[model samples]
Target: MTQGRSIRLFLVDGAPNGLLTAEIMNWTGHVLTGPRSKLSELVQRPECGRTGIYFLVGTDPDGDLRPLVYIGESDDVATRLKQHNRPEEKGGKDFWEKVCLVTRKDQNLTKAHVKFLESLLIQNAGAMGRCKLSNGTAHEYIGLPESDRADMAFFMEQIRTVLPVLGLDFLRGIGRPSSNQQPEPFTPTQPETYPLAGAENPRLKMEVKKHNIVAFAQELDGEFVVLEGSLARGEWIDLKHNYRHLYKQLCDEGVLVDDGNGFKTFVRDYGFTSPSPAAAVVAGRAANGRFDWKIEATGQSYADWQDQQVSAAAAQSEEMEPT
Candidate 1:
């Protein structure tokens, strides 16, 4: 044959949840018939089209992996290799290392599959997606090598085999199944309520503490203020709307008082400022500020307030939707 043919093989082990897997992969290797060797030689040759290998670990956009780790392709193989092996150097974590350890200890995986995996990993450099195997968890990109098509075929086969193992072994940190459904539309019970005009919920509960603070300072205080936190932790905006308009409203209403260096709120007379201690506290207490604070006039939660805004926006959009 003048041109080498592509060969792909796949095997899945265990039940509905795969315990193990294996595959036979051959791509674009020059036709050679000596003891099935020269595989290494084929890998070395650039013309053979060994395009390298990569692993795509499935993850949410936020970079959390839950289900399967996919091995595939790359252009800068050296960088990809370092990315997988050196945890701290590459984002302080390495998922490939974890999977390899498990595979090493568990002989359930086949020799061919193992070789495919080992070569695929050793050859590639950077990894795409989350590395749950690593201590720190986040999605990342890997640099792959340029070689031949054969390597690509081999790596893809290995990936196919390994994916089944995730389901069977019940890997904890693997990303959710690729087939998992997207979230349904969010429907709120009430949408007409707004947050307390101003409140600072600064108890620091970890979940929505920052949001509460922003809600309090921006929505309630009606001021344009920038809050700085720990450097790496970054900053957050309390109010989602236009800070300048809110600031103008507060200034025009005389609710914001300039105190030499910066500004503070005189919320008692201002309708925009929250009536409570902080926005965080209000958010934590109830979804709707009106109901949570017992502000009988609104009879709604912060969530309800959000819903009302969304509904109004949607209505406006519909009216403007080319009718």
Candidate 2:
């Protein structure tokens, strides 16, 4: 079972969108995040002078849904951030609109420690494919002592845990079964099938007979994940629809690859904010995902299944309450 964690968040300026700091109980790591416009104020904070890693995040200028991110580490993050905030003519990056800094409250992080963190973060972010990384080449750092390496690994895990609470999920990988639900062993022979094992959230299938596309998806951790090896329409037919651009972006990113016929295959599991976009991508047109995605076991639509779950939960809650 996963243990519960206590996290404290403080809004520095007492404004929800203003500068903020986050810390976890019994953890030395600290996170400070704010918009680009607050660079002057953010740099003035004492933590900015410490050795740490920082992330610059913003939307892709090309209008892709995935944000553009650049990760860097510095002995003096304040100075480095100042350089990054300069005019583009001075080799500064103008694409990023928000900055998140990760430092330690104890101020024990060293140059070598942050370098290792930066490299590992870059590698994980690249592997996750949740954002478009602005980093050109990830530097290798192998000089840390064995014990320090272990400490840094724990630090990285804390960063991963804290980041999502701050609305930064680029490092969050594809969804997995919840703690109470254990995944069934995967069979290579049945590449297209995902065993449900009577789980509450069953695997859903979306089929477009006209396009000969078959896709599999599941809801995990509140995100709809289109499993790898699922098939989607080779060409997006709804040109004027907003989701067409998303389909094109996925194709460009190689998440969807041509299968040599009239369909594209998902190279890896990809998470979407909701099922509508997932359905739209697989069907090659705008689709009502709640109606289109059906439970493989009972042929119930996602909407119906979701409704049943909600009703059951409400009834259970009422039964548990005092008269």
* Top candidate (lDDT): 2
User: What do the candidate models score in CA lDDT, each in turn?
Assistant: 0.31, 0.87
Per-residue alpha-carbon lDDT of candidate 1 for residues 1-323, written as tens digits (9 for 90 to 100): 12343333222222322212232233222211111122233223332232333333333233342333534333433344345445546552333312211221122233344344444342221131112222222223223333433444343434433433433222111111112343221111211111222222211111244433222222322321112120111122345533333444433543444433322434332222243323322232323233333222343454455557789989999999984
TM-scores for all predictions: 0.20, 0.92
- Which ten residues in a row are the worst by lDDT in model 2? 185-194
**Tens-place lDDT digits, model 2, residues 126-182:** 877788999987887889998998898789878978999999998765665344555
Residue 176 of model 1 has an lDDT of 15
lDDT of 2 at 216: 92
- In model 2, the runs with Cα more than 4 Å from the true position are 177-198
Ten-residue stretch with the least lDDT total in model 1: 224-233
Error of 1 at 43 (Å): 32
Query: What lDDT does candidate 1 reach at residue 49?
Result: 36
